[model samples]
Target: MDRQAEFVLRTIEERDIRFVRLWFTDVLGTLKSVAVAPAELEGAFAEGIGFDGSAIEGFTRVYESDMLAKPDPSTFAILPWRSEGPGVARLFCDIQMPDGSPSYADPRFVLKRTLTKAADLGFTFYTHPEVEFYLFKGQPEAGEIPTPVDTYGYFDNTPHGMARDFRRQAITMLEQMGISVEFSHHEGGPGQQEIDLRYADA
Candidate 1:
């Protein structure tokens, strides 16, 4: 086993981690996860865990549904939200076929392939994404638009801005996961908010 994999095993045992969630995304970029017991991790690192890909959107058809999720040790991190009981950790996985080949339908594999091609061409790909979202007062009725939490505009700063507190909490959690945020602020629309992520190699 590699040094990273060994390190992961040691950490799991020391932390008393009970569940390890293997994470991946479908072609549509929807996050998917499957949890495994800590005892099965060594085998998972060796051969990967199998699942039926046909159930996921944009994956293989029912006939060729068998897929493997090989966890990437480098992306392992303890989930901060689950602070009670035995700890829960997560690892981003690389999807593979039954024959141990990279699946073309895997979004992470496609991105990695693109990054490799870019490196071969003497270019480094980087991205700084500005994510925007709206805050609704509550869940709306069927077909009815929800009301905005506030009438805040661009860069608006209020002493009692709920959006401000939300952003602060979000950034804190993201940092705990080793993700860096460039900045965040209110957008021009009512209850709209924006967060700019730090530029990183894609």
Candidate 2:
């Protein structure tokens, strides 16, 4: 095991971790989870836990329904996004068949496979998402026109402005969780703003 993996296993034991949550995404990149108690973790590390593959979207057909979720220890991290406890930690899993081969339909696996190919060619994939959204006065009704919440231009700081305050709060939370923010600015459309996240290699 590498130093990081060793540290995670040691921390989990020393910290009295009660649950280890395995996470993965579907073909459409929707997150899914399964929680296993600390007692079963070692077995999970060896032989993966099984579930009904047909139930999950795009996993398997009804005739052959068994699938497995094998956790990759390296992805273990405390879920700062959640406030649950016995304190939850998450690991990304590789979906597998009952006989132990990787399931091609897993979206996480697809990303890993693509990254692996990139690695073989001496390249890496880096994504920097610029998320843009708008805030309106209230939910728009059927055929009801939407109006801008504020009239502030790019980088204009007005005291107690709703749009400015909301974006600041969101960026603060993102930074607290170790996400780096490059910039935040008002977009061309009214009440619309954009937050650009800094890029990093996985």
Candidate 3:
């Protein structure tokens, strides 16, 4: 076996891993997971796991429900947030037809194909996303904006407010997971926030 692949197999075996989580995303970028016991890893690698593609959004039709998920070993990483006590890590999979052809509709595959085109043209595609989201109480009604969870503005401190502390904790966790944060600030919109991640090679 290759050095890196051998190293990963050895690490998993030595760590007493009980489960291997296969991770992937739907067309809309929603994260998905399928966990298998360690005993199944070898089989999974040799023969991709079968799943019903029709069940996933924008995957396939009912008549052609058969599909496979082939794990990409390189994306293996311990999910730091999952409280599994450290022996477990995840591998992202690429979707394929039951016959083992790449699923063109897979969003990750779409991105990969686009990047390949860029390579053929002597350029590379890069993406740096600025994530913006809000933490609201329950679900707000139409045309009705929810009130800010806290009155803290920018770096202002409101003793009773948990939002400021939450942001700090979130940034810390992101850093722990190796994500570089360029900056974070309270957006002009009430209860809205923005986090700018540093641009880097993927």
At residue 51, what lDDT does model 1 achieve? 96
lDDT of 1 by residue, 48-157 (tens): 99999999898899999999999999999998778888899999999999999999999988999999999999999999989899988878999998998899899988
Which residue pairs overlap in candidate 1's backbone?
A: none
The pairs that clash in candidate 3 are none
Cα lDDT, model 2, residue 55: 86
Q: What TM-score do all the candidates reach, one by one?
A: 0.93, 0.73, 0.80
- Please list the residue runs of candidate 3 whose C-alpha ends up more than 4 Å from where it truly belongs after superposition: 1-3, 84-87, 136-147, 153-161
Residue 1 alpha-carbon offset, candidate 3, angstroms: 5.6
> How large an RMSD does model 2 have?
3.7
Off by over 4 Å in 2: 1-6, 81-85, 133-178, 185-193
RMSD (Å) per prediction? 1.6, 3.7, 3.5
lDDT of 3 by residue, 173-192 (tens): 67865678887777655566
